[model samples]
Target: QLHNFCSIELGSFYLDIIKDRLYTMPADSIGRRSAQTAMYHLLQALVRWLAPILSFTAEEIWQHAPASDDSIFLQTWYELPELSSAGALNDADWQRIIELRNWVSRELEVVRNKGEIGAALEARVELWLAPADYDLLQKLGEELRFVLITSDAEVYPLTEKPAEVAEEQLGVAIRVVPLEDAKCGRCWHRRADVGQSAEHPQLCGRCITNLGDGEQRHIA
Candidate 1:
């Protein structure tokens, strides 16, 4: 059965992808998310094909798939009905989004190179897009924002040359700049002037208190 071979192969393949090179696909290819997506689709096709035969195990696997809500058998067939329609699922759209994400990720990598890790996603990105591109990106809202590892983001027309900002080149290219003199002390993110915690004035107040407890525990 498809499941029999796939279950064994997938575990090994996914681990290899993760441990060896999942994050390092050619920058010119689709981004990390697309790599994840391709793996997911491969498994999904295998699961559904096997569900009719393997029954129980396929459902178990499907249940764990992100955003899958129904029984695998009850879900729509793998093939989409809208392929011939005007709004047919387009490969170009997916490629564009993935490319944009890859571009953004490279920019974040530059920040990491500067000895920072885990910047608060919402506070660290400022996207400058051509007018048409800005309009296209705004439609994605926060889902795309998170994919780019920014806590919050806003899209703007590229009116003039961007201010001197750090940049990274992936499939496309992206720029990253430090936010204003804001800082979140607890997490060490660069937005300290937010939320309402006065006790740790330079730190985001929430993390300040949370860290207090963790610090006490560490001391003991």
Candidate 2:
């Protein structure tokens, strides 16, 4: 049954169904990214079987799945993580990380509102931490910055005030600054535009469908 279920059309349809349900459900029901990532794992499982049948389509979808690298064909087949005995991730870790990510999004949006537009992960950021959380921040500075969508980040001394503060004190503050002259017109994030016409200024080839900034262009 599992072998039979793997195919490009089937895999994509499965993702569509799960994504639709996840987005349509109440926010309190589940985390959207978590649901989507679970869908990615399912798709990855099917990718091996589907790659020979639907090479192009599988690659296309795989590229959009952030968890994947260049080509699913190049990547090894998915193996279910063995969780039989003791080693396993618990819900609390996921919850804590989710909360941190949400807070990072909120803070990043606030910084972006202050004319930082399109500040992506890998942008230099300064994080102000509470004294109690300073050591933790120092230990995970790179990881936190990467997850929070910042270039480089440093956990500053506790007294630094964040531009936006949550209703309930997060005891953490973040500041993001876009690197100068590193803008890609397409994704608007700082990166080498792999697909730019000679005439275009830093446009990503992969993001051709995302033409016209600040304008809603329906892809479907």
Candidate 3:
């Protein structure tokens, strides 16, 4: 159970946060900082929690962690924060998002098998949903694209079913198109604005805005 908590639950949660929220947000933005800070603390707690079963490995990780003490075994047992805490995703909301994501993944796989797109990030997705699902899906806003791991996403009310529609059970249809925009050199997200900036010609608009001062620092 502990291994599943660390490897599956925590791992997927962190990956979703990074891909959807952290990477998409401007580096200097408060939202990005808050997300990164939460991830840092979660990882710290995870290392300490795992120390009992993974003593040597956990201690090695703890030793290298900033502000960590002599031994991870000396640390108190990890306690998860309340669900109402900042940056927390409610269980129901996450379940709905996961279902939508799975729908997109199924469609992406169809395209991938035909060698139409190499990666989910390399495709643009169009989502058609029943009128009943529109409001719930709209609640996701722009984050829907990130959840689907696509270069672009467009949501529309379900009309006549197209031959390419992926799933019928959830009243959701997906269409994948190869992303036409050049991929940003820094972040690798395909964006039409990639070469528009004169100063940062190789970067997307988001990367250009975040790369202020251009002074690189190694985190380790």
Candidate 4:
């Protein structure tokens, strides 16, 4: 579970929430501020939790971190927040999502082997699954795209099983295609609106909107 917490939970928070969404947004934007606040608190909890295992490193981190206490040892044992506090999906939901994401990765590998796409970010994915799985994925909303790390994704209900898939794993099928959009100079994600703005032609719509005079925040 610790491995899952570090790799899946915290990893997703850093990649999807902080890097993908917050970093792409303007420093002064409400979304960026909100995400930063959440990240700050989460980091404090993580440092305290890790202190038992990595005392010296944790203390070093705590010294530089903004907190009420001077030392991490002064803090109480770390308590995980409620699952709902982190996301709408529960453990089971996340497991299914992970499985689906793995399937996408395998399919992306096939296309990558053909030299059709170099990066996962340069691929568009199509997911075909049973009605139940489709419903679960739909609950993820826009986050599904971020979870897959693709330029675009679409979920469809399975009709007839495709010939390419084995019988046992017929419940899910994935297709990866090279992304058609120009890559955004700022975020490096392929987007259709990359050249829409004359002022920031190299950036996507989101990047252009978030282009502010203030320095962008970096996760140290």
Clashes of each: 11, 7, 0, 0
| Candidate 2 vs candidate 3, TM-score winner | 3
Residue 128: error of model 1 in Å? Answer: 2.0
For every candidate in turn, the CA RMSD to the true structure comes to 12.6, 14.7, 4.9, 4.5
- Report the C-alpha lDDT of model 1 over 63-171, residue by residue, as the tens digit: 9987788799897668522225363324575456556665666667777678564453524567666665566676666434444545446666565436564234321
In model 3, pairs of residues that clash are: none
Candidate 2: segments with Cα more than 4 A from true spot: 1-41, 44-79, 83-90, 131-141, 157-170, 181-220
The order by descending TM-score is 4, 3, 1, 2
What does candidate 4 score on TM? 0.81
lDDT by residue for model 2 (76-127), tens:
8788655444533344543454464566567668767776656454366665
Candidate 3 per-residue lDDT, tens place, 69-138, comes to: 8788888876766555464446775666667777778888988999988988898888788875666667
Candidate with best lDDT: 4
Greater lDDT among 2 and 4 belongs to 4
Q: Which is the better candidate, 2 or 3, if ranked by lDDT?
A: 3
lDDT (tens digit, per residue) of candidate 4 on 45-150: 8887789889998999988887556788988866655444454566687778877887888888888989999988898888878998999998866657677878
Which 10 consecutive residues of model 4 have the lowest summed lDDT? 211-220
Instruction: Single out the weakest 10-residue window by summed lDDT for candidate 3.
Output: 211-220
List the global CA lDDT of all models: 0.53, 0.53, 0.72, 0.75
TM-score of each: 0.45, 0.39, 0.78, 0.81
